[model samples]
Target: MLKEKVALITGSTSGIGLATAHVLAQQGINLVLHGLVSATEGQALANDFIAQYGINAIFDDADLQDVASIERLITKAISTMGSVDILVNNAGIQHTQSAESFPLEKWNAIIAINLSAAFHAIQFALPAMKRQGWGRIINVASVHGLVGSVNKSAYCAAKHGLVGLTKVLALECAEQGITVNAICPGWVDTPLINDQISAIAKQQDSSFEQAKYQLVTAKQPLPEMMAPAQIGEFILFLCSDSAKSITGAALPMDGAWTAQ
Candidate 1:
C-alpha cells in the first residue's frame, strides 16, 4: 500500500524529516519535500531522490508559520504529486528560555510552526485523504510532550498540543482509513541536539563528547542518544500495513525517559 504513494514531509531538507524522506523513498514512495531552501537546492535534493531511489520528487518551500502558506503547501503537493498519501508534520523550531524570559516573537513562532502548522496541514490534507480512503499523518512530537523540563515552556506546550491534536484527529478519522499519531522521541542525534550539547559543553566547561553523554543520560535510562534513522524506520513501520491499528497513540521511542 505504501509503494508509489506520495508523502509530503515538512522540514524535509534536514533532521528527522530528511531521514524519514530517505526511508520512505527507499520504499518507492514519491515525495514532496518541504523546507526553507533555494529552488535550485531544493530541486537538487529532490532530483537526488529520483536518481538514487527512482521515485518521483518535488519540493515546496512553504513557511509553516503562516496558515495560508500551510494550505498552499498541501494544495501544491496535491497538484504536484496527485495527492499526499502520507503527511509528516515534522517542521519545528525551538527556543531555550524560561517562561518569563521567553521572547514574544519566539513563543509565537514556536506555537505557529511547531503546533498550528500541523493543524493547518491536517485540515487541508484530510479532504483528499478522506476522498481516497487512505492516509497517514505522523506528527514528530518530543519526549517533552509526554513530560517536561525547565526553561522549555514553549517547546513543551507546542509538542503537548501536537500530541493532543493527534489523538483527536485519530478518533475523528478512525473509520476514515486515516491514522493520526505522534512519535515522541528522546534526544535524537540531530543538529538540534548537537547545538544543545554544545550549549551544555560551554556552560559546564565539558568536552563535546562529555556533553553529549551527560545530555543523553540526564533524562534517559538507556544512556544513549537515538539515531535519526531509527525514528525514520519507526515512522516507516507506522506507515506500513501491519501497523494499521496503531492510531491515536503518542508512542514514545524515548529510551525510557518518560517511563521514569
Candidate 2:
C-alpha cells in the first residue's frame, strides 16, 4: 500500500530524517527531501537514493523558519510528486541554556523551526490528504517532549508543544482516515549526541566509550544509545497499516528513560 506514495520529510539531508527516508524509499515511496544544504549537494543525495532504491526523490532547501517557505515546500512536494501521503516534521534546531539566560533570538529561532514550521507544513499538507482520504503525519519529538531536563528550556517547550499538537490533530482527524503521532526518542546516536559525548570526554578526561556510557546511563537505564536507523524502523512501523489504530500517542523509544 505504501508503494508509489510520496513522503515529505524535513531535515532529510542527514541523521534520523535521512534514515527514515531510506526506510520509506526502500519500500518504494517517492520522496521530497528537505534540508538547509545547497541544492547541488542535496541533489547528489537524491540521486544516490534513486540509484540505490530505484525510487523517485527530490530535494528542497526550504527555510522552515519562514511560513511562506514551508507552504511552498508542501506545494512543491505535491506539484512534483503528485500528493504528500506522508509528512514528517523532522527539522529542528537546539540551544541549551538556563531559562533566565536564554537569548531571546535563540528562543525565537528554536520555536520557529521546531514548532511553528511543523504547524505550517501540516496546514498546507492537510488539504491534499483530506482530498485523498488517507494520510500519516509523524512528528519527531524528543524525550524532552514527555519529560524535562535542566538547561533545555526552549527545546523542551517546543517538543512538548509538538506532542500536544499531535494529540489535538489526531483527535480532529480521527474519523478522516488520517493519523497523527509523535515519537519521543531518548539519545539517539547522531552527530548531535556525538558532539555532546566528545565534550563530556574532554571535560572529564575520560575515554569516548566511558563518556558515552555515563551520558546514556545518567537518564536512560540502558547504557547504550539507540541508532538513527532504529528510530527509522520505528517510524516505518508507524506508517504501516498495522499501526492504523494508533494515533495521538507520544510513543517513547527511550530505553526506559521516562520509566524512571
Each candidate: what lDDT?
A: 0.93, 0.94
Clashes of each: 0, 0
Q: Write the per-residue lDDT of candidate 1 for residues 197-255, one digit (tens) a residue.
A: 89999999999999999988888999888888899999999999899999999999999
Best by lDDT: 2
Q: TM-score for each prediction?
A: 0.97, 0.99
Score residue 164 of candidate 1 by CA lDDT.
Answer: 99
Q: Which pairs of residues clash in candidate 1, taking residues 3 or more apart in a chain or in different chains?
A: none
TM-score of 1: 0.97
Q: Write the per-residue lDDT of candidate 2 for residues 156-186, one digit (tens) a residue.
A: 9999999999999999999889999999999
Q: In model 1, state the lDDT of residue 134.
A: 97
Please give the range of 10 consecutive residues that has the lowest summed lDDT in model 2: 230-239
Q: Per-residue lDDT for 11 in model 1?
A: 94
